[model samples]
Target: MTVGTIRPGGRTARVRAAVLEAAADALVEGGFDRLDLADVARRAGAGKTTVYRRWGTAAGLVADLLADMAEQSSPRTDLGSLLEDLRANARLVQRTLTDPRQGALFRAVIVAAAGDARAAEALHRFYAVRIAEWSSCVDDAVARGELPGGTDGAEVIRAVSAPLYYRLMISKEPIDEAAADRAAEAATAAARAGVFVRSAGAVE
Candidate 1:
């Protein structure tokens, strides 16, 4: 398989993964302001038109890059218990952020997102995909009566990483096992306390 060929998704998804990986290299090597479409294309070994056609501007490219990230990442499958599932999610997030290459890639996106609408949109999609992946675990919890019927699985999943990201992006602290555990604890406690469940038994 090609460098970007063997990915965890479909054909289009594989191509996107290759592009994202190349874009990541460009971002890390050149920083936020120096990202060039040609460079990305060259790095990805993909045609420049393909890059521009698929993602539009640099911001758009960045956005799609994030979406690709969420896709390549393995979704959280049933792992017996909610807490265990959540722990798995936390660990995944922690590992990805801690990884030098992926971590820098995320930082690049965060910086690009500050002033770019396209990048911002892509970041949103990325989070949405990631959150949805783990939310199923919370849903399973409710179905199993491990959590209440009204529990908000999405919120529970988001909670697992909100603080973790906060520390990584803001305080620039480490996202170690302890931090992941803390995130899981706080979010789990809030989830158990009915923080995410809908009040009227309807989607909000």
Candidate 2:
């Protein structure tokens, strides 16, 4: 079903939900390269034609799945302090990346993004949405005089998750609450020191 054909809480929506869930399961179990439209349709109990008509390719399905994931992601926490808000963001990322199925699914998508241009665009958009969602914490902190003016809210939010992702994707180390706390603390310290402040006359 096309987007124009989809109505709220209708069969199209149900099919989309099922297909996206099945796509996530397939990615978690076998990675993106093994994601087949027919297999996903079978798993979702939808018609193969419907799946193909709605999402033409594996990349298309993955892109739609990423969009859905972004929409379903948790909202930012507001604890009246930059450090506490950052800690909440860090812990959320750490928890997601540490889960067995979710970790594998994210790794699969990251790997796919590395090799496919369309998937890469979708993955970047996913992070952009998430960062924008949490950036308000830094904005709120600045208003409260906790962080300096002109601090890059998006960059500060990214800093909170960067180390956790590094461990999950590169260092292959343990990603625990301690690691999350350390990331949050480091980002908070850096933000307090103006490390993420916007440069003057640099076009941001």
Candidate 3:
């Protein structure tokens, strides 16, 4: 269903989405540290009592917002081959980086997460969910003997796009198709080189 068509679970979920949508708008306009729940309530046209009753604090609101983001995110698809799958994943990240709304929202949340434990945990969960979803492609490759049996699916997934995020945040660089291709190539080469493969009894 489209975002506009989505009906939240109940009153709380509805209130929460409203609050988060307001916060997201503010995030795009400014940054997370500047986000005030009271302002959000005002912008959302939600009652202060309801907002406080549901979220308790600004951190709780941010955590809920992050959770909503993770839930709304697109699911990863397995396209029969690792190269194609990684390309799809790269393109997904590239699209996000290029998106006016999403990129600004992510940067705001990430910057706030640097100092807020709640935001940090929420952001961590967001990445963890995304990684697990895409890592299935790597796992499939190993299962098909395209990669070594002991390959680390999670690391391969992370290796592909960590630099994309780095460039987005650190250098404020544009993540173009060329960047996405390079990311996919680097990750694929590492997989080919067995960089993610775990040797037997490698727990040491």
Candidate 4:
């Protein structure tokens, strides 16, 4: 089997896994601007025609890649407390952004989203899926009377991650454990203070 090929017993599945792995490698090595379908196919050891036929365009390939990532991402951690859950989420984000390969891949995808509408939409969807998954922890917190009755779980989750992303993408600061802990702490404090509560007339 080729690098990144999985023995899932299906040729199509193996091909897709290989292609997505190759795409990730290419993105890490050469940002989104240099992502070429033919090169990715070559690296994946898949036929160029097959890649083109399946993905159609670079944007399409990226969209699929994001989908795969969202599918494979870790499930939310339920630690019985909102603070602990937020901390877990923050640490996970920190670890991913601090990893050499994952950090590069995320940076490439983010850059791609800036110039490609499809990529942007895919990126948004990926985060939405993640947020939805983790938002359950916030819901649990509200049920436990740790937060306001109408606290926006998704918004709370986003608040825990936004600072970390800013450090990774904009401020160019270190996304270290300390930063992650601080983010979680701040978000938890805000949520406990009802900052994340939805207004009475707000859309659900």
Candidate 5:
């Protein structure tokens, strides 16, 4: 079974929740550089040895935290209009990147992924899950004839949030409602223009 597949009972589940919460706090407070297993255990009120035995390493703990986050993430919106659904997704991304605690945590994780292989893989997995969930919106769009029949749902989904992420990670600009709306509009227009249509032999 996968690391997150097990359904621990009662105390075990509580302990895991507490530990993961502490780990997120640590990341938000000081980033990945200061994420220590012992410190997280202390913050969680769990035994250091238990934390060490369960998670083994800071990177391992971070990976599990990301897995848990993926599980807890909100479901995709299903507004009938493709543009509306994309706008909802863009606004969700905008809100997350602009929120105080969530923004800090995301920045810390993103920074960690930049320098650590495990963190990078975990980050990729997280985005992959999110993209899959939101791709349904594009699928719906294709069914509604809003986009080309061969439109790549995943690509359309990625286009919606890519600009918001760029602002959060690269441009250091403000991620506001306007930015989110613009991103949604741009992606919707491109999708309508068949920009995300899958070509023959395209690796999906």
Candidate 6:
């Protein structure tokens, strides 16, 4: 099997779970620069050879961790109204970014992506999965005539979370409920005004 693949209900699966947990702890403590396979093995009570043979490198472990995260992420909420759905989405992002462990883990991964190509790809894939999941909310809105027929669901979803992430990663501002609500409102207004609609001349 490929790296990070888990066998069903077996020692292999247990080992994978343990290793991923240890990896997350390591990231939370020291960021991606200090993620070591042997250390992860020791922390997980698994064999060093197993960890090395399976993950090969820190980036490989990060990639696998992101895959697991994508698999385990929550499904989007549908609240009938577009604004309400987007507010829910933004609030979820706010909660995750404000959580002690999840926030630190995300910071480590974001920092890792800054200089590591493999980590960058993994990060991109993770967000892509999340965005697609929430994009359905926008799709439902368009169908209900709450948004323009050609509104880009994915972009609207991105807009809703963009400010929240900026606060988490750039401005060092608080990711409070008010901030989340503002993000959702701005994105909703823009989307309703047809800002997110794809035009024939728009660049893909």
Question: Which numbered prediction scores highest in lDDT against the true structure?
Answer: 4
The lDDT per prediction is 0.78, 0.90, 0.83, 0.92, 0.90, 0.91
Q: Give me the runs in candidate 3 sitting further than 4 Å from their true place.
A: 1-5, 8-10, 199-204
Please report how far candidate 5 places residue 81 from its true position, in Å. 0.5
Give the deviation of candidate 6 from the true structure as CA RMSD: 3.3
> Which residue window of length 10 is worst by lDDT in model 3?
1-10
| Model 2 Cα lDDT, one tens digit per residue, 1-204 | 111123379777888888898898999899999999999999989999999998999999999988888877888888989999999999999999998878888899999999999999999999999998899999999999999999999999889899998998999999999999999999999999999999997565
- Candidate 6, TM-score vs. the true structure? 0.94
Name every residue pair that clashes in candidate 6.
none
What TM-score should be assigned to candidate 1?
0.85
Indicate the worst ten consecutive residues by lDDT in candidate 4. 1-10
**Model 5 over residues 1-204: C-alpha lDDT tens digits?**
012333567889988988988998999999999999999999989999999999998889989889898987889999899989999999999988898888888899999999999999999999999999999999988888888899998898899999998998999999999999999999999999989999999987
In candidate 5, list every pair of residues with a backbone clash: none
- Candidate 6 off by > 4 Å: 1-8, 201-204
Q: TM-scores of the models, in the given order? A: 0.85, 0.95, 0.92, 0.96, 0.94, 0.94
Tens-digit per-residue lDDT, 21-120, candidate 1: 7877888787668888888888877889988888777887776667656657776867888777888888888988888877877788888888788788
Which residue pairs clash within candidate 3? none
Model 3, C-alpha of 89: deviation from truth (Å): 0.4
What order do you get sorting by lDDT, best first? Answer: 4, 6, 2, 5, 3, 1
For candidate 4, the TM-score is 0.96
Output the worst ten-in-a-row residue range by lDDT, candidate 1: 1-10
Each prediction's RMSD over C-alphas, in Å, is 3.2, 3.7, 2.2, 2.3, 3.4, 3.3
Q: Model 4, range 122-201, lDDT digits (tens) per residue?
A: 99999999999999999999999899899999999999999999998999998999999999999999999999999889
